[model samples]
Target: MRPEHLKVLIVDSDANVRELITGWLKADGFHAAAESSGEAAMRRLREEHTDCILAAINLPDMDILELLRQAKLLDPAIEVIMLTSNVADASTVQAMRLGAFDYIVPPLQRESVGLAALKFVKYRNLIDENANLKSGLEAYRKDGDILGRSPTFEQIRHLIADAAATDIPVLITGENGCGKERVARAIHAASSRCSLPMVMVSCSAIPEHRAERELFGSECGAPDGVPYPKRGRLEIAFGGTLFLDHVSALPARIQGELVQALQRQMFRRVGGTLELPVDCRIIAADSADLAALVRTGEFREDLYLLLGAVQIHIPPLRDRREDILLTAEYFLRRICAAMNKNIVDFSEPARQLMQQYHWPGNVRELENAVERAVVVTVSTYIQPMDLPPLQTDPATLPASLSLEELEKRHLLKVLPLMKWNIKKAAEVLGVERTTLYNKIRRYGITRPLRRPSGSVQVPQQ
Candidate 1:
């Protein structure tokens, strides 16, 4: 992950120069902090996240060289820019050798010094952002919630950024095992309430009889020996996020109560008189079509609208074919490290098989397959045999396979060969033009530009 936000420290004794650079940095959309002495600047470095430093070559307490050395020792990632009146000085050359980012000579044109500082800020952000991304992926991969690095995944990341920027209820729609919870965690991690607890409620797993008490808690003053009041998932998640998994499974009564709480931003415990404030952010996920459920009156319309106000949909893995092998390799390294195995890479056939097979179970299935492969393989390179055996019977698809995915996968295999000719594809599918068009729209399928030569489609439906 590389750093994006920049904080610059100006350590010049000249208040005019400090104000001058500070204004330039603020205009450039960077945060600037000023210190009159090297000692104060060093203290600031220790307490704050200072990405770049603009230290005057002469300091009140110490030389610029000493400040440069101390700042680098504090955090090597910090890029120090030296501000000086004399480039001809020997100490300036020594400072450069000692790892100064760049030096500024006055006649300090905002254009020149500002440009140099801007350059350092851009470089600093890139470095930090990359470091952060890697760190986040490593943490997520441990939980089998690896977000891939693909164009499609980038768009998903952008959506995630938007979701995290707000506190409104967010609805995550995706097939099973598509990392819905991972996205929820990501939102919570990026939010202002990150330090607080993010309580998760599994709507499908909760017994229907206890759904109310589980979500809204129970009133105190019990008839027998119980003395303390039981806290609910919502109460525990206050000042943070409450993630509802399989939210579509909530009964109609509970759904209505949720809608009321969301509308008023207040909720009361079971058998309680006082209404408690609802302060937590709500994030709900479901594998089912909640809008469809609403149409059938199985889900509350108001609750559906509230939860889905800021919605994110993750397409099945088969739709993101480009990420398949990449994601597989990422898991391969992670799993190998976990297992302490010496396995190197996947064979070409293995890669083709993994990319072609319809990943009905999405990322979770891919991770499990890699873990199983690591366990079974004895050689450095993983062969096709190392992966778990998949049902290859095209004439008889497994009953567990969803029809939507089955047809979408079929269309993907055919459209490339048909060169994405609409009429040709329709004729091949033995469907009318309108029917094929509708299916394409429903599945949100896009045509690939072209396929590589000497490539074979691995057999799996």
Candidate 2:
């Protein structure tokens, strides 16, 4: 927004007019430059970053109208203000029709010309900022695209299409961090109400004391930060979807109240006694087993039946081992683009190890791991040493190995990854070189030497 940070271009066939405009811009603290003909001005535009261009109606080499068209083609953000001697000139209307931002009469005072240029520059910056925000939002929506080629994932996609065709209440069940919210969003985006907003209510995040007032509307003394009557999230999501995350965590009394309102398709405010219509579709998500809770008398059976009319379950990552490498590669590409890195892919061993490890935390853990690897990796490819030390499940290993034997086995696997580089291995282990040397001596660790006869020898580290 500072004047000195902006560059302005003044294009005029007459030397005197160019001097006047240049002096006006310079006096206003702008970094101003001048060009004699429209052709020269277009050349300068190509070589530098110009914020605004002031072009004369009469040009020596090119028509002013032609220059305006080319300037917009080159960069539409550059504000073009036409310089004319007559306010009623035919070219004035033509320039305005051709996307001229403003018209400046020749021989104007310094203040007039400077203020006009500054105003247009600030406006252009705001437009650019708004465009960037929209672009980022669009990218975010697309990045969460459902991404798996497994048969179960294919079934989920088909179920989503069926859910979108109607307004039936849906229940999404999954382990923690298994993309339940993502599935909910896909349902909303594909439904007829895709143009409407989708509001989410985190049932577990809201306190039990304030749950009722947050779901239904409240008069004056509402807990959601308003001194006057407040419309709850359910009302705000009128024609769209109301997503209930952790639905099983709602208090018992609130759950009962929700049942009556949902069945009758109406609700009332917390303090007031007037009935209001319920127009939003419901989509609930829970990581717990709601059916088991209902059987144990912990969850209401009627509420479960209403919410679980169309149940969709997401399997954990360990159950879908075939999709691990594909999903990891997807996360790698997205994370590298966000971090502005050119990391190509993972080493073959890293890929195998990632797929082999039991991902108890599911997709959330995978995304975090890929992001950490991208941060620490120095080369174009991610090496296994760059990844965090994975906690392997004991059941996957030999049953009789002691703690010392397991540690020694891990050291042997990690040393070969970095090619027996002591300092690199120590860095990955979060220990000093002296400690690594002591461990190597204590465990008698060595690198295997390859021989021409297809045999191997052990060389002590």
Candidate 3:
């Protein structure tokens, strides 16, 4: 990585140390700026974009640990390395506890400092790449289309494209609110009969008494005792696509009728002897596994085979974590527009909370959350307090709550404001580095350590 591309902030009270380090860093092609005190370091941090911070353990009127905390609060992605000459064991442990990327005893090690700077640059690049991928995927979800960049979503898209060219029946399986209907619509829109009206029927919504008549239109009645003819959903859907949502909910008798319609494309209206032939594409969606239902005798094996000529399964949101942040941003923009709010973005804490929560209700749940936040947020930016409390059980702490819980409840809240690292966390808790480590070890608080995959994995309790 090019050092010039990586902005480094050097904070030290000693003028000679700051000048020596700044000159070396600039000579090495880095964009380095020096600050003589903790307060000056903070001002530089706010005024400039820093990729990494090289800070001393002590500065005038401020503690180095507290400075680290403040820097993190300003930008969590900014890498911080602590410098000290005393080489005290407590200081080393305290630096890490304050969330420093690495602790060094100076006279500085040039190789280590260079390597740490490169690591920060690489991490920033990975975050950019993830964001880019999400943007590309979102570009495909135009209008009412369900677009996904995740492998599972890409597979679904490919299947939909293949299924669209044919008139064969398609069975969409997924949990409720998984956008099964959207998939069905995409198929219809891409099909050869795109010009024809696409009809939707919820088998579960129709009453049992009306289901037969609804599927097959009623016949025209003669004078007093004769019945009138009415076209059913199957006949009305001729030359178009008939989307049967919740097809598994169809009555047994209606399932038999549907099978006959599929085979012959002809069905007689009630009270009428004349058979009407209709040509239409069939698409069925069910939340449950029809094969299992068939095995249990609730659904016919033959009917399952007929309807499931093509199957498309939509994955739940929990399985697509990569898309969550993008989707949240999308919803935020859309909801803010509709609500006439000027909300521009979510605070870091708010964004992190959204990413960590398990969205059990899928996209629908996210949509609701975004809408709620947009409505309740008073400022232009949505903060964590603006969002609904995550539905986490009090008795069962999150499995990977170490880094997140610590950052949310303690580190982030104290650091950036204090402009000092160790002193800040220490002052707040009334403890020193040794005392803090003992507490962190006792409480099992994990730091925001990076992994080889460039993903953050907080240790669960």
Candidate 4:
């Protein structure tokens, strides 16, 4: 917002007026350049950044209104203040409509002009800062998109690029928080369809009765007295990408219909006569095994074959332990910036603990942990105490331990530490609310009775 950092363009056909205004601006600490005609001023504008334009009502080469239009088109952020002797004329109204920042009369007051210029300087600085922040955010998102340099992670990137190179239907399978949707977006961004829409459909969130209507549009009045014609997600995503999340959860009827649509590259709207052609590339994701579901007759085999043309699996964090600290640092920077915290880095013990722990919830859990630590920590660095307790892997337990016993023990340990909050416990356990609820019922996990304050013991686990 400093005046010396701001550049002002003085445009006037009169030599005396141009020199006077330029001198006034420069004396006020702004970088000023004067041009006698509108054309010369526009040429200067194209070559460099101009924070404000002081244009006369009339120019020898072109009209002042035309110059203002061109300057605004070139950079709308640049402020334009009109200078005219006939301040009460209708032309002044036209100039204001054309996006003039302000109007100054013949008796140019230095104080008024300086104050206006200073306000515009502050406005320009804010615009520049917002633009820079947006650019920085975009770079950060792309840089931290898939954070791992491990061999498996590198292979995943190659597969993503290969998938992006073509329009083949993609099937991304991984655990809950392993970033299936992020991979889908990366493919869409890199593909030829980057300019088009990429619509996401959560298959598990829709009800069985409404699934058909949501994917395929319904008629205005064929089935009932409908108000208007509605476009479905498929139609909306034409010439782009359709991302189906938790595809395995799709109903059997919809699965069969979807397979037919995929094969024919077209589908008819529900209660409508028109056959809408499908122009979108399909990408499906699920944590469960689709082949296993097909074997159990829970999913359609044909749809599975159509979607699994090019399958990509995202490995869990435990399998790529070397990338733990790198990914953690990425999240740390992002969280600290968002929280406006000055925490520089994680303590050595915290870093060691993060590397040693198996992140069952994957990147999502790591993000949540870093955000929580940033919000809670008072010191300059994060410590192990700021993080949630590491969960014990059920797979790593002794072979003699029963599955029921392992579930009961994990529930008992995590529930107490989470203060018996089902939502938080579910996040730590990396399971859904219903899934956690079922486990709690099966294992008979419950909160212990409250004790007197003097004798209460907190569970360390």
TM-score of each model, in listed order: 0.56, 0.60, 0.53, 0.71
* Tens digits of lDDT, candidate 1, 1-461: 12226678889898998899888888877788899999999999999888888888998798999998899899988888888888879999998988888998888888987788767856766776878876875575343354676787788787777877889889998977677888898888777777687898889778788898889888775322256688889889989999998898788899989888889899998778789999998999998999999899898889988999899888888788888888889889989999999998999989988877876567777777788899999889999998866444344677887878888877776566456776665544544355567777778776543476544432211
Per-model tally of clashing residue pairs: 15, 0, 28, 0
Residue 167 CA displacement from its true place in model 4, Å: 1.6
Candidate 4 lDDT by residue in tens digits, 1-461 = 68899889999878887888888989989999999998899889999999889888888888877888899899987788888778777877898887888878758778867877877877778888878866754664464277898999899889888998999999999987787888898888778887687899988778788888888878786345677777888998999999999898788999989999999998988888789999998999999998999899999999999999999999998889988889889889877888788998999999988887777678777777887888888899999888877646545778899867866876787788777777887776666666687777666555555765544332222
Best-to-worst ranking by lDDT? 4, 2, 1, 3
Predicted structure with the largest lDDT when compared to the true one: 4
Residue 155 accuracy (lDDT) in model 3: 87
Residue 363's lDDT in candidate 3: 73
Looking at model 2, residue 328 earns an lDDT score of 88
Looking at model 1, residue 264 earns an lDDT score of 88
In model 2, the runs with Cα more than 4 Å from the true position are 1-144, 222-226, 397-461
Model 2 lDDT on a 0 to 1 scale: 0.82
- The model with the greater lDDT, 1 or 2, is 2
Model 3 agreement with the true structure over 40-137: per-residue lDDT tens digits: 88888898888888888878867877887788899988888778777566766787876778766655767766676667777778878878755643
C-alpha positional error of residue 420 in candidate 1 after TM-score superposition, expressed in Å: 42
Residue pairs whose backbone atoms clash in candidate 4:
none
CA lDDT of 431 in candidate 4? 60
CA RMSD of all predictions: 18.1, 12.6, 29.4, 7.7
Per-residue lDDT, model 2, residue 305, is 97
